[model samples]
Target: QVSSGDSSVVIDKKKDRRIRPSVVVAALRAAQQREPKFKHEAFIESLALAYDFVIASKSMRPGAAVKLLDVYNVLTIMPGSAREYTRPEFARDIYLLDQSGHVTTKKGRKMSLPASALTRSGGVLRTVTRNGQAKDYAGISFEEPGA
Candidate 1:
């Protein structure tokens, strides 16, 4: 069995290139068993590597950091270098998504938070009164255990 760590390497055989679904499932199961000890991103990254998935990036360190941040409910689908759009609506939506725990940015990576995290982070909404009044409200913040 291959040990789990940064220095570990997986050598795939060209003759037996068939992907074993069971191995992938087993890796995921093992990861799930250790879920409590890992953040969402760490769990996924560990499982992905356990199944021999290659994380493409400049270096393994950054790749791991990106993966770790992913478990924290940050979405980095769109790169920071993405072209800036002047539309207020689009900008507002992205900001709302970022604030609502749906997405988070760190070190140039976008990560998605689990639904449980999203619900816990609180919802974002704008209230408008019929009497031509509008108010912006911030949602309650949920602190993680030991946070």
Candidate 2:
């Protein structure tokens, strides 16, 4: 707001909190940090496919699970993208998948990934949980959704 006092013009900004939407958007964009684009369903589905491939070749049963390393190998073997799929990313995805409950009957359909699925069989895929707890999962098993 502007006011004419004597021979001088005074401007007051204390009450002017309004800003143009475009300007605000520009400011926000400039200050925004890049976030990871983790596609939950796609990534998880890829993981499940890789696991299936590994499990089938190994002739794994419901009580048995393919090694984490084996699954990772299957996923990275063909190099689907230019950016390499790192072990850390694989680990994080697994953790996120578990937390999502998408593979269990509790949430996603036609799958039951019990705690036994993540039991450490041999070598481990160490991951940090959503709550920041360090976890190690050696293998993964998939069962009937209602199981």
TM-score per candidate: 0.19, 0.57
Model 2 scores worst on lDDT over the 10 consecutive residues at 7-16
- Where does candidate 2 clash, by residue pair? 111-145
- Checking candidate 1 for backbone clashes, the offending pairs are 41-71, 73-113, 74-104, 74-111, 75-103, 75-104, 75-110, 75-111, 76-110, 76-111
Model 1 earns a TM-score of 0.19
lDDT of each: 0.32, 0.58
- Superposed by TM-score, candidate 1 places the C-alpha of residue 70 at a distance from the truth, in angstroms, of 15
Over the stretch 35-102, how does candidate 1's per-residue lDDT look in tens digits? 23214444333323322222333333322322222222232235551223222222233333444553
**Top lDDT model:** 2
What is the alpha-carbon RMSD of candidate 1 to the true structure? Answer: 19.4
Task: Please state every model's RMSD to the true fold in angstroms.
Answer: 19.4, 15.3
| Candidate 1 regions with alpha-carbon error over 4 angstroms | 1-18, 36-147
- Model 2 deviation from the true structure expressed as Cα RMSD, one decimal place: 15.3
